[model samples]
Target: MSAKRVDSTIVVVAVAAAIVGAVALLGVLGQAWMGYAPSHLLTYLPMILLPIAFALVAVALVRAALRRRQTEVGQS
Candidate 1:
């Protein structure tokens, strides 16, 4: 991939990550507002999802960075 393509992919991934994070946060808040009682299983649902989402985002960002580096090196 070219530098331009890599940069665009990074931007798109970042935007997607932000959207997913927002939706996950909203879901957690909504559940709380609905008076759902905290339990061993119920309490950790949001926390679990949040980390998984973040990890996925991190992976995408790293992949983009690596691709950009590879393209740059290849052009030299």
Candidate 2:
């Protein structure tokens, strides 16, 4: 996939989805803690990708932030 170009818009969507999925998973986990049905947790299993997606977005963001900071430091 790196051999071809990917759209920036898609990456943004993935990052958004990743964040929502992670929050939903956390909510489901909270429900389990409150003595809700164990089956409810099963529904959230598919959200595991959120953490991975979140990590990807996080890395990219961190890199960008550091680069910007480095530029500012160099200029000053």
- Measured by TM-score, the strongest candidate is 1
RMSD of each: 5.7, 5.5
Clashes of each: 0, 0
Per-residue alpha-carbon lDDT of model 1 for 27-60, expressed as tens digits? 6676779987445444455466556657766866
Model 2 sits at a Cα RMSD from the real structure of 5.5
In terms of lDDT, model 2 sits at 0.63
Residue pairs in steric clash, candidate 2? Answer: none
Give me the displacement of residue 28 in model 2, in angstroms: 1.1
Please give the TM-score that candidate 1 achieves against the real structure: 0.50
Worst 10 residues of 2 by lDDT: 1-10
Candidate 2: tens digits of C-alpha lDDT, residues 1-76: 4411233544676677776777677777777899986454445653566766767677666766776776655543
- Per-prediction TM-score: 0.50, 0.45
